[model samples]
Structure formats: structure tokens, C-alpha cells
Target chain A: MPEPLPDEGPPSDLVSDVFARDCTSRSAFEDVTAKWASLTLLALHEGGYRFNALRRRVEGVSEKMLSQTLQALERDGFLTREVVTAIPPRVEYALTPLGQRVAGRLRALADLLEEAAPEVERAREEHPGRAR
Target chain B: MPEPLPDEGPPSDLVSDVFARDCTSRSAFEDVTAKWASLTLLALHEGGYRFNALRRRVEGVSEKMLSQTLQALERDGFLTREVVTAIPPRVEYALTPLGQRVAGRLRALADLLEEAAPEVERAREEHPGRAR
Candidate 1:
């Protein structure tokens, strides 16, 4: 055979261009590190939930923003939305398997980020009059 | 004395509240992960540079956006901008020590991300026509 037909799309060069600014990893960077996305990913990974439940659990998310965020996540394939046939028509969102794995890793990073709080605080104070 | 008054301002619970979305780290999240900020930080960490030099090195950075990115980084204390009171007013920017440490860590992460590109690509291919 001719090189086994080279499976899948060409490999991503996220690493090579990751620090280069114009690299493809920028998309991943933007997605994973956005304000509420990682946290939202964590919540969805737990199980399926309705819109109201996510709003309540996410803390400080406006309905408009939550809906927008969910749409973005769903677009990225990190989440799957299902609509149940009911009187009012219920909709629920949950993590796909890939999202689950990514969320698990992100959750661990979140834990580390939590532990780094004291250091970040000190850094902040050390530079008091700084900050943008 | 009173233990030096515990140094300065209130301790930031960034790590603890990181997953909460409304936490202070949200600011950090917004700053660090923006499209060109990380790459800009990397370039700055290399050494001080005038505005145009950075634009040239970074590739695809608009002058307005570069200025904005620099201002944000300066505000975060990750960069220090010094204006030379000369004929054309030369201003050069460089990393503060703390910024160097952060850039170092982020650079490592970028490298890991680059390395993981193949896997991410594989995941994408496996999912086929997925991705948001």
C-alpha cells in the first residue's frame, strides 16, 4: 500500500508555533484559558444539566453569557447538547468523552492554580503600585 | 512589631476561587491568555525593545494592538517601559524579574502544548468534522 493512506488531517504544529503568537495553538489557548470556559468544562464533565442548573452552579454568569458560552463550547465539540421531548422541551448539556479527558486535566491545573494563590498574592503585593 | 503587618493587601484567593469564575484570577486569565500576550511576553523576556522592533519580531501584530498589549503587560507589572528623553523619544521595554519567572513557566507550557499537537490532531481526526 502507499504509506497506509496517512491517517487523519495533517498533525498540528501547536507546539512549534505556540509561543510564536500566530501559531494555531492560539485557538486552543483562547478556548482553554478563557474566563469561565475551563470551569464550565469542569461542571459539564460531572454530568448532564439543564440551562438553569449550569447558571446556578457557575456563579456570576449571566444567562446571556452562559448561553453564549455553552454555544461556543458545543461548537468546539467539548460539549454535546441534547433536547428532551417534554411539555416545555427540556435541553441538557454534557461533556463528550474528549471533553471529559480535557476537563480532568484542566481540573488538576485548576487545583495547582489554587495552590499558587499565595505566591501570586505575594507577587502582587511585592509590586503594589503595578497592575494593568 | 506585628509580623510586618502581614506584608500588604489581602491575600488573593485566586487559586481557591479560580474555578469559581468570579475570582480575581479571571483578570489574570483574561490577560495572560489573550491572542498575542503570551507571545509578546516571550519576546519581551528576551530583552528590551522599541515598539517597532517588537512588531517586527512578533509577526502579525498591529501597531495599535502591540501598544495595547504592551500597556496591559506593563499594567500587570510583567513589563517595565522606559522612555528615553531624546530627540525622537526612544522608549524601550523589558521584563521585570517576576515577569521573567512567569514567562519561563508559560514558555515551558507552550513547549508542552507544541509537543502535544500530534495528539490533539489525532483527537480531532478521530472525532472527524467535530471541533468548535
Candidate 2:
């Protein structure tokens, strides 16, 4: 709640400064950058998917973890959960406009990391002593 | 270690496919997207900072966490640590070329989050039950 830059700009007061200890954006940052959150956002960015499909695409995400991740994304306005009352409750997850924008950036980062993975592997192999 | 896309293009074998359970890039993804790692990268992207200065800039990071984060980044080739054998043996952290590329993307994501933070706050307030 401490306004560091009072006269900065229009949204200065509500700005999400991760550097600020009390900034709500800190939680936002954590939520978006979390391991499952990143994968979930990337998967949703591709298209809407049912719970099981999403879980499959993400790979290795447990049922409970996926559920928690989706709920967090929904609460952040980055995802929408729709329930299609079928024989069994079929829930689908998709990204909102805001989520799309965020996911686009995340995808770019993911791509960069993917592209650089080779070099990173080399570095690890060369510096086996440093591998952790 | 499972080769999913054997017929893919060059570097496909080395690709950091996070979707792969045993991908080396999964560790890289985790390192770069980590909360302290993200902040540390952003901080170094600005300029080289001594250990104590970095701790101050990051805010709320413990001494141990900072050390561990630095080690991870360094091992991933995202950060270069130079030890200045002065009276107190000062160590400086800075971004390498790879680090710069990764940090640039992270900064963009951080900027996007900062811009969208107000809306996220509004969403949280509207759905107090969803706040977590």
C-alpha cells in the first residue's frame, strides 16, 4: 500500500512493481511465472481444452495441481472455466484477452529457452562440476 | 530422454521441450522463471551489482536464497559471476549474452504484468472469494 512513485503516471498507485514488497503484482508475478502456471497458460493459449486433455498436454501435472493452477489463473482473469453439464460434468478452460496477451509473451520466452536448450546442455556437460 | 520428434529439424534433439518429462531445458525453464531468478536477472540486466547491492535491489531475498539463485543462473549461463579479490573479496553478478536475451524477454513479461496489474487487482476485489 506504500505508494513509492506517487506522481509517476495514471496507474502508478495500482502498478504491479515486483520490486516492491507489498505490491499485489508480486503475487501476480509468482502466479504467472509458476511452473504449472506457465505450462497451463501456454497450453490454453493454443486452444480450449477439457481437463483431461489439458492435463495430458502439460505432462506430469497431477489432477490436484492442474485444478489448483486453473483456479488461480481464473481468479487472475487470465482464464475462464466453463462447465458443460454432460453425462459427467465436462469442464473446459480457455484464455481471456488478458490471458492471451500474457501467454503470447510467455510463449516467446518458452521458445527462446527451447532454442537455447542445446547450448545450455553443452554448458552443463562442459561444467559437470557445476551441474545441479 | 524420450525422443518425441525424431523427424524434426536441426537442434530438435537439443530442443528444450518443457513438455518432455526428462528435458534438460525443464531445469533451465525453472531457473529462469523462478521468482528470485527473474528478479535477479532483471537486476543484472540493468548493470553489474555486488552481492550486497543485489540483495538490497531485490528486496526480501535472504542471503542464502540470493546465493543459491546466483549459482543457478550462473550454471545455466544466464549470469557471470566475477570475484574481485579485493580486501573483502567482492563478487559481481552480470548477464552474459544468453542471459541478456533471456532477461529481455522476462523484462517484457514483467512490464506486461505491471501494466495489467490494476485490472488484476480489480478482478480480485470483485471476486474476493477467489483471492488466494
Could you give candidate 2's per-residue lDDT for residues A1-132 as a string of tens digits?
A: 875855656654544687887776777888999869998999899999999999999989999999998888888889888999999788889999999999999888888888888888777776545557
Worst 10 residues of 2 chain B by lDDT: B6-15
Which digits, one per residue and each the tens of the lDDT, describe model 2 over residues B69-97?
99888878887888899997888889989
Predicted candidate 2, C-alpha RMSD: 5.2
Q: Give the CAPRI rating of model 1.
A: incorrect
lDDT of 1 by residue, B26-120 (tens): 55545655667867877876788898998888778889999888877666566788889999899899987766765765565555545545545
TM-score of 1: 0.60
**DockQ values, each candidate:** 0.23, 0.64
Give lDDT tens digits, candidate 1, residues A1-132. Answer: 455645777553323565454554555545655666766876776788899998888778889888877776665556778899999999999987766766766555444445555555555566645454
RMSD per prediction, one decimal?
A: 6.6, 5.2
TM-score of every candidate relative to the true structure: 0.60, 0.87
